[model samples]
Target: MKVRAYGKLNLTLDVLGRRPDGYHLLDTVMQSISVWDELDIQTSRQPGVHLQCNKDRLPTDSKNTVYRAAKFFLEDCGLADQGVYIFIKKYIPSRSGMGGGSADAAAALRGLNEMFKTGLTTEQLMAIGARVGADVPFCVMGGAARCTGVGANVEPVAPLPDCWLVVCKPPAGMSTPRAYSILDQYPLSSTQATPRMLEALEAGNLKRVAKCLGNRFDETIRLAPVRALKRAMVDAGALGSMMTGSGSSVYGIFVSEDQAREALETIDSMGRTFLAQPCSGI
Candidate 1:
């Protein structure tokens, strides 16, 4: 089974309080982008999971989300005796807050269900995915949604208006845990980012939607390359630009593909770049 796992972007991320379990509460609007990681999985009678990746640095053992996800799903299906050989071809940049690992985990669950003929519904798959990662539920469902409660609770929302976007990851990546730790030092903002973003999408006003772009983590992380990427996007004609998720990667909402391409080139030297649009769920 071959699955294309799409990466995500946070148009608006608001930090709430933290739970007793140390999980930070959040209200973030998520959208799946065109950037993706491809997984080719094959089942075998041998009772163990083997994994490989194009990026040699990425772990292929239990440390990898893909391997863990396969194990979890197989155990759930009462197929623990089954084995899978999984290969990942990565396009989405890691450690950029793009949910690359979560996406891979989600894809493994979905592909395994199909390959083994397990009739798990989307909700079931998403529920199972949540155990693997906080963002895995959203990645499993894909497309647009308001994710809250440590990003496992996903409420589907209207897709963003058709448009082009440019995403760039700075040379240095941000640690999600470290980013959250830094953000925890600050108080929660009164600004209602997700509500306004929902309204903007519902109204089908791209410009208004662009104005809704926001992320609390971006405010906390003072990375120079991130700021430069946003600045170049704005100067090159982006409607609005901001860092997605925690940090490292920044994206710009553009009026046209041409403008998006220009912004990509403008900031390409600063880091890795991708030109994409909001897409639907798997």
Candidate 2:
């Protein structure tokens, strides 16, 4: 089975507070983008998960989310005796806060279900996915969603209006844990843009959606490249721009493909860049 696992962008992210378990509460709007990673998976009689990636630097063992997800799914489904081999064609950059790893894990769960002929429902798959990673549930569903409660609780929302996005990731990547730690130092605020962003999405108002773009991490995680990239995006005619998820990768929303392509010409050489649009249907 072959599966295309798509990355996501945060339309708006707000940190609520730290939970007793140390996981930070989050209220955010997440949208799957056209950018994706491909996974080719097949079942085997051998009772172990085998994994390979085009990117040699990534781990192929239990440390990798793909391997862990395979184990989790098989165990949960009472198919622990079954095994699978996974080959990954990676596109999304690691640690860029694009949910690349989670996407891969979600794809593995989906492919394994098909390969094994398991009749699990979408909700069942998403529930199992949540055991592997916070973003896994959202990645499993794919499209526009409001994710809260450490990002495992996903509520599908109306799709955003068609628009082009220019995504850029700097050489330096930010750690999610570290970003949350930094955020914990500051006191909580009542300000939140997710509700307004959702309202704009429901109304199909692209301009309002652009104006409502916000991220709580932007206030605490100050990376010069991220700031510069946002400015460059606006200077190149982006409707609005903000860093997605934790840090490192930034995306700019453009009304048209021509404008997005023009902005890419100016920002592409600056770092690893990609031009994409809103994606749906997994």
Candidate 3:
């Protein structure tokens, strides 16, 4: 079986608190975008997982999350005899707070489930995914959602209204560990959640949705070049814009397709650009 896993952007991410497990508790609005990776999996006569990818940035070893995920699932279910090869075509930039790797791993799990007919429930898949990474579970079940409890707890949120998205990535990658450390060392500034946008989404109000868009990470990430790109996009005509995840890539939401293309040209980068829209579900 083959599956295409899509990347995610955070419109609103607030670190609620640190957990006893040492992972931070989070309250974030996550939206899946069109930027995606494809994973192909099928039963193999060979005895173990074999993986290949066109992206040199991605490691093909067992250290790779997708390889680890397939191992985790088969070992957990005593399906070690099943063998497979995964071919991944990646477009999402790595470590840009875009959840590319996590999405790839989730896609592998989903493909395996179908190939094996495991009939694993969503909760079961999520539980297995969580063991791999905090964002893994959420990626497994694609869509817009409110994620909490270190990304394990996912509550369905109304999808953001149909809008064009322009994403920008900076040259420097923001280390997730470093971002966490920075947050730990520094006092985090607070921002109000976009309850109005959430309401707008539920009501299918595109204008209101654009008006209510917001993210708390702006205070930290905006100190860098990424903030400038985001500003450029907005100034060029994005209806709404914000930094996506921990740092680096930012997205501009636009009402008109033509407006979105214009916004992208304003922020055109050697880095990367993904022109996409809000999807209903994963």
Error of 1 at 198 (Å): 0.7
Colliding pairs, model 2: none
Clashes of each: 0, 0, 2
Candidate 3 TM-score over all chains jointly: 0.92
Error of 2 at 42 (Å): 1.2
lDDT of 2 by residue, 170-263 (tens): 8878888888888888876468989999999999999899999989988678789999999999999998999999977999999999999999
Cα RMSDs, all models:
1.0, 1.0, 1.9
Please give the distance, in angstroms, between residue 217's alpha carbon in candidate 2 and its true position after superposition: 0.9
Clashing pairs in 3: 142-282, 143-282
Top-lDDT candidate index: 2
TM-score of each: 0.98, 0.98, 0.92
Compared with the true structure, the alpha-carbon lDDT of candidate 1 equals: 0.90
Report the alpha-carbon TM-score of model 2 versus the true structure. Answer: 0.98
